[model samples]
Target: MEGKTVFVDGALPGESVLMQYSSVRGKFDEGYVKEVLSRSADRVKPPCEFFEICGGCSLQHMSSEAQIEFKQSILKEHFEHFGNVQPETWLEPLQLDTLGYRKKARLGIRFVTKKDSCLVGFREKRSNFLAEIESCAVLMPKVSELIVPLRNLIGSMDAKQSTPQIELAAGDDALAFVVRHMEPLSEQDKEKWLNFAEENDIHLYFQPKGPDTVHKVWPNDNNDRLHYQLPDFDVELAFHPMDFTQVNTSVNRAMVSLAIDLLELNGEERVLDLFCGLGNFTIPLAKKSKAVIGVEGVDSMVKRGYENAKRNNLENVDFYQADLQQDFSEKEWAKEGFDKILIDPPRSGALDVVQYLPKFGASRVVYVSCNPSTLARDAGVLKEQGYRLVKAGVMDMFPHTAHVESIAVFERNN
Candidate 1:
C-alpha cells in the first residue's frame, strides 16, 4: 500500500496523492487524490452533481475541448492504423449542447422499502448500490423530470424486487416506458402502471423478454407512430422504441446536414444508403438527390421504411432488405448504379461494404459511424479500392459518456 498507486477518475495523469479505496475500480476504478497528485491541464469540475457516482458518463471531468481533442486523436489513430490512409481534409467535428441533451437512456431500477422509500436510479460507479440521484443533467429536461416519479412508481410495483431496468423513449407524439420486470407482475403492478400512465399521459411497455416481447398493457394500440423529422425534407419516418438512433436528436439533424453537404449532391444523382435504419440518411438524401435506395438487414424495418416513403410522397426512394455482409453486386443493384452513397452503419461500422463501395459507381461517398475502430478498418479498405478519404471528423453525440459519433467523406480518385 505504501508504493502502489491506484488510478483515480478525477486525478489526471501525472498527479500524486493519498487515497482510500471506495470500490474505486468499478464505478471509476480509482481514488480521489488527497493532493493534486499529477493532473492533466484539461481537468475540470464536472457539471453534474452525480458525475462520479453515476455509471452514465465517465469523461465529464475532462474539459469539453479536451474531450473533443482526445476523441479526434482516437479517430486519427484508428484510421492511420486500421485504414492505412489519412484524409485530404479533416472536417470540423460536430459539437452539441454538452448537458441535458440526451433523449434516450436505460435507468437502473431498485426498490428498498425498508428505508421507507423506493430508490430507482443509475448503478453506482463500481457498486450495485443506486446513485440516489434527484435528477440527471445529461438527459433531456422532460425525460429528466421522470426520475422522481420513476422512483415512486417502482415502489408501487407489486414485485418491486423484480424490477431491474427502465427503457425510456421520448417521441414526438407520445412518451413510452418499457419496464423490465424479472418476475411475474401482480395485478396491482399492472394497475399501478395503468394509473401512472393515465395520470402522467404516458404509455407503458412491459418487457418480459427482449424488445420483441415488449407489449402495451393499458392502451391496446400503444404505438403513437413516433418519427423524427428530417430538416426541410418534410419527411417523417416511423420507428419503434428499440430501433437504433442517434441519442442527441439535434446533433443527428446536424450530422445529416454535414453528410448531405459532403455528398455534393445534384438533382441528377442517385444515392445508396447502406445499413439504413428507417431511412435516417436515405430519406433526407432524397430531398436533394434524384432517388435513394436504402438497404437494411431487418425485413420489418425495410417494410416500414417503404411505407414511410409513401407517407411522405417520396416515390423515388427504394428500400431493400439485404444482409450487408453478402454480395450486393447483382442485377438489382447494378441497374441502379449510384452516383453518391451514404453509409451509416452501426458501431461495427461499414466493414464489408467498403469493398463494394467503389464498384457501386459512386463518385462521392459520405460515411457516418459511431465506432472509430471499425471506421478505421473500413477506411483502409476504401483507400485501397481507389477512394480517397476526403474529409472526416467526430460528433459528440453522447456527452459525459465516452461514446463517439463521427462522419467521413470519400471520393473516387479522378
Candidate 2:
C-alpha cells in the first residue's frame, strides 16, 4: 500500500498477484498478472477457453454473484462520489443468465497467411490483432457454434483477405450476421454464403462499404425481420441488423417491467420515452399509460418505432425524430405536458434532456443508463431540479464485462 499507483490487469482489489510491469508512465504504471500468488475466494475458473486471449470479457475470473456485487459497489461509489447524493432505497440487483447472454457483437476477422487460417472472434486483449478462438462462450449458443464454421467459410472464399469484420445480432427467434467485405464478393462466394445460411437457418447480410450499405442477401421472402417480444405487454419490436437493441432479452424484459413499475403509471397519465430506439420501452409503456410519446435522434429508428407501435396494434403512441442534445422547447410535442418520463440515453447520459424535466411537469422520471459515471453526473442535475431519488439499482445486462446498466427513479418533491 505504497503511494505509487499501479493498474494491474487480471487482478482484483485485495488480491496478491505477481504482475509484470507492462508500461511506466509519468502519473501511473501498468502491469499484467503473471501469476496469482494469492487468489480471492470469489475467483472462479473462466468458462470460455479463449478468455485469456480474447478481450470480449474482463471479469470472467470473478464469479457471477461477485461480479454483480462489484458492479453494484461501483454504482454506489459513483453516486456518492460524483453525484453527492444517495437513493433512499436500494433496489435488488436484477440478474439473469450470466453466460451466452450476448445477443449483439462485432467480431474482428483476420486471415493470417502464416497460420494459413482465418481467425474470427474478438480482438486479443489490449491488442488490435484478432484472437485465435475456436468458439466463444458468451455469444448465443446458436451464434457461438458458428465460429469454426464461419472461419472455414471465410477461409475458403477468394475475398477472405478483404473481409475485416462480422456484426452479429440475434433476436428471440432469429439470428442475423452482417459480413463486412472491402471488395466485391465473387459468384462462388455468394454461393457459399447462401449454402451456409440455408444450412444454418440464419439470415445473412453483406456490408460492402458502410453500415447504411448493408443489404440482406438471404431469405428473399422479405418476411424474416428480426424481432423480440414482450409477452407481458403483448408488444413486439422489429429492428434491423444494425439497430440498437439490448444485448440481453431476459434482462430487458425484466428491466422494462421494473421501469414501468417505478413510473407508477396509472392509465390516465401521459408519458415520454426519450432516446426511445425502436420503441422498446415506448410501446410497452403505451399499453399502461393513456398516451406515450417516443423521441429518437435517428430518423430511420423513429420511423421504425412508429411502425412497431402500429404492428402491436397500439394507437396511443407517437414517435418523433429530434436531436435530444439540442433544445426542443418550440417543438409541438414538447408542449404536451407529460405526467411521467422514461429516459434511456446513450453513454453520454441525458444532460440535455434532464434540463427540461422541470418544465415538462413530470411528477416521476425513470432514468435507465448504461454508463455509471454519466448517470451519476446526470443524477446531480436531476437533484438540482427538485427531484428526489427514490430508488436505484444495477441490472446485469452485461455480466462478464465492466459495462453497467442501471435504473434510477426520481419523484418530484411535493
Candidate 3:
C-alpha cells in the first residue's frame, strides 16, 4: 500500500490511479480513478462533501443513469452468461426519487473519548470507526437532518455510555428513532428524547436489546399505524417496523403490479404466494384471483398475512407456514395446486421451491429478487423444469446505490 490518493470514489473501469487498500468489510481492496476509463458515459460528481469517506452511497459518485444502466446490464449479463436464455422483453426498470428517498436507515454511533464528544452517523469507508457527520444527503430529510441533533442530544444523555447505535425509520408521516442502549434511559434522557420529538415533529423508540423488545419511550398516536397504499385496488397494507417492507414504496407498487400482470389472473386462478411476508402481494392478488395461499417461513408474518387478508376483506387469501426449502413437497402440499405463482423470497432466491414446483403442477412463476446472480441460477433451474423466461426487469428500489431489485416471469411451455 502506497501513501497516495486513491480514486475509490466511482473510478471507471480501465483507469488507474494511486489508491490505498481499504481494510473495511464490503470495501474494495484497491481504488483507482478513471482517467482514460470507458464507463457507461453517465458519470457525475457525488453531491456529498464526505462522499469518499461515507460508506452509504458507493454509486452516488457515479451518475444515477449509470447506476440504473449498470443494474439493467447486470441482469442482462447474468441471463446471457448463466441462464443462456434471453428474455422476450426487458421490462423497463422502475426508477424513483433520487435523494431524501430512503425511508429506513441504521446509523453508527461512536463516543470519541479523547475528544470528550460523541459522533453519530454511518461509518467511514475502510474504517471501523464512525464517520463524524453533521448531516446526510441520501436519508430521508427528517432522519438526515437529525444526525447532528442526535449526537448532541445523546451526548447530553445520562445513559450515553451504554448506547451504541441509532436506527431511523420513517413510515408515511411517522418518524421513529430506535436507540440501541446497553443501559436504560434515565428520566432526563427520556425528557430530552421527548422534547426532541415534539419540537421536531418526530417519534422516538428505544431498543434495550433485540427488535422484539423495542417500544416507544413516550406513547404515540397509535391511530396511525405505519401503512402504505396499493393504488391499483385501493388496498392498504399496515406493517410494523420489524416487518419486511421495501424502503422504496413506489418501486414496491410497481413490482406488485408487474407480478400480478405477469401472472395474468382471470379471477378463477389458484395462486400460490411463496415466501410471502405480510401479504406484500398476496391480498392484492386475491382481489383479482379466485384464491391465494400465502406461505412463509416466519410464523409471525404468516399470522400477519392472515390478519392483513381479513382486514382487507379478502376472503380468498389464505396464509400458511412452511419451510419452502425442506417440507414444500410434504404429503399435505399435494392437496393444493397452483395455476399461477408469485415468489418474493430473500436474496437466496427461490431455487428450492422452483425445483419442487414441477410436482405440484404450476402454470407460471413470477420470481422477485434482490440479488441477480441467484435469480439467474434459479432461472436455469426453472428452465430445466420446462418454463420459459417471458419478461424480466429491474426496479431501482435503492437509487444512487448498487442494490438491485428485479422481477422475472416464467411461463410453462405449452
Candidate 4:
C-alpha cells in the first residue's frame, strides 16, 4: 500500500490489523478488518451476539465514552474544515443510557423458506439482506422482547412473504407496532395479531399501503397519538406513530433542556422555533418566553403542534406551516421579530432557514443539528450574516453509532 488514504471498517485508531480490500477508488481505498494483529485500548467486546452481522449498532466494540469523544472530534473537524471557524468555548458532551434507549425504528421483515422462519431485524452490514436476529440490545426493552414473538407471529401468517417492514413507535407508556404488508392479511392472521396485541398490552396497526393507509386494529380506542413528557417544563407533546421524533427518550429530554438552556430565554422575550414538529421545543419555550411561534413544513405536524399546545393548556404558543427550504419573508409571521430563535432541522440542515435569520433580527440563535458537515456549512453562512459562533457541544443521541447530534449557539456581533 502506498501513501494513499484507506478507509477501513471494523478497525480502530492506534491499532494494527490485517485488511481485505472491498473497493478501490482513485483518491482513497476502502477495506475491512480481516484480522487484528493489535487491538486498541478503547476497543471492547460487543455485548450483542448479533453485533458481527447486524447493522443496528456499528460502534458496539468501542466504549461509550470513546464513541462520544470520536463524535466530538468529528464535529470539531467539520467546524474547522467547512466553517473555517470554531466556537469560543466547547461544552461538555451530553450523555445518557447508551443501550436500550432506541424507542422507534423501522425493522426489516423477511421470511426464509429454508429456515422456515421470518427474519425480523436490521439489514446485514454493507448488504441489503436482512440479518437473522432474535433480540436487539439498543432498542427499548419492551420492543426488544417482542422480536422473537413477532418473528413467530409473522412466520405463522399466510402474508409473511408480503410483509416487508415493521415499524415500532414507543412512548413513555404505550408501544405501537405498525406492520407494512403488501397483500391483504387473512382474517385468521389478523386475529393472531389482535390476540398478541391484547396479550402484550400493546397497540397494533396495519399499513397495507402508504403512510396514509396506516390504521389501528386493536383496543378500538380513537386515541391514536403517543405522548412523551418534558418534566422540566411540565409539558407533554403528543405525536403520531409515523411522525419524526428523537429515538432516545431520555437523551431527548436532556437535549431539549440543553437547547433551552443555551437559548437563555427571559420572561419578556418572544421566541421562534424553526422546524418545530409537534411543539417539542415550542411549548417549553412558551413557558419561559412571552410568546412562541412554531413553524414546520408539514401541515399535520402544525395541527399536532396546536393539539399539543391545547393539551398542555398553553395559550401563548402558535403553530404555522411553511416550507423552510424556501423564502417566506413577506409572510405575516416572518414580519414579527423574535428576541431568540431555536432550530432543530433534519440531517439536510437548514441553510435556507439560516439565511433568513438576519431578516428575523434574532439576537441569539440555538441550532441543533444531526449532521456536523451541514452544520459547519451553515455556520459559515451565519458568520457572513454577522453572527459569531459562541459555544457548541455534541449530544449522544444515537449511541454506539457514527451519527453526530450536536448543538451550537450563535450570537449577533455588536
Q: Candidate 3 on 1-414: residue-level lDDT in tens?
A: 245434365565454444444433332344434343354455677777777678777777677777888899989898878778778888877887788778877888877778878888887865788887787788888777778888888788887778998777667657767778898778888788889888887666778988888877544765424677888977887766656777776777777887898888888998888888999899899999988888899998998888788788888888888887675676464467789888888887877888887876888889999988888888898899999998999889888777888999988998
lDDT of model 1, residue 290 = 87
How do the candidates rank by lDDT, highest first?
4, 2, 1, 3
Give the lowest summed-lDDT range of ten residues in model 1: 24-33
Clashes of each: 10, 0, 1, 0
Question: What is the TM-score of each predicted model, taking all chains together?
Answer: 0.90, 0.98, 0.91, 0.99
- Model 4 — which ten-residue stretch has the worst lDDT? 323-332
| Candidate 4, 88-186: lDDT as tens digits | 999999989898999999999999999898999999987899998989999998888989999999899999999999899989879998989998999
Kindly indicate the candidate among 1 and 2 with the higher TM-score.
2
Residue pairs clashing in model 4 are none
Among these predictions, the greatest TM-score belongs to: 4
Q: Over 4 Å off in model 1, which ranges?
A: 1-8, 13-35, 38-41, 113-117, 128-130, 218-223
Judged by lDDT relative to the true structure, which candidate is superior, 1 or 4?
Answer: 4
TM-score of 1: 0.90
- Local distance difference test scores for all models: 0.79, 0.91, 0.79, 0.92
Which tens-of-lDDT digit does each residue in 356-385 have in candidate 1?
A: 676678898888888999998998888889
Residue 124's C-alpha lDDT in candidate 4? 94
Residues 1-414, candidate 2: write the lDDT tens digits.
267799898997789999999888888899889999988999899999899999999999999999999999999999988898899999999999888888999988999999999999988998888999998888888888999999999999999999999998988778998989999999999999999998999888999998789999898877647989998898788998899998998999999999999999779999999999899899999999999999999999998998898898999999998999898888899888999999999998988898888999999999999999989988999999999989999999988999899999999999
* Prediction 2 global C-alpha lDDT: 0.91
User: Considering every candidate listed, which one attains the maximal lDDT?
Assistant: 4
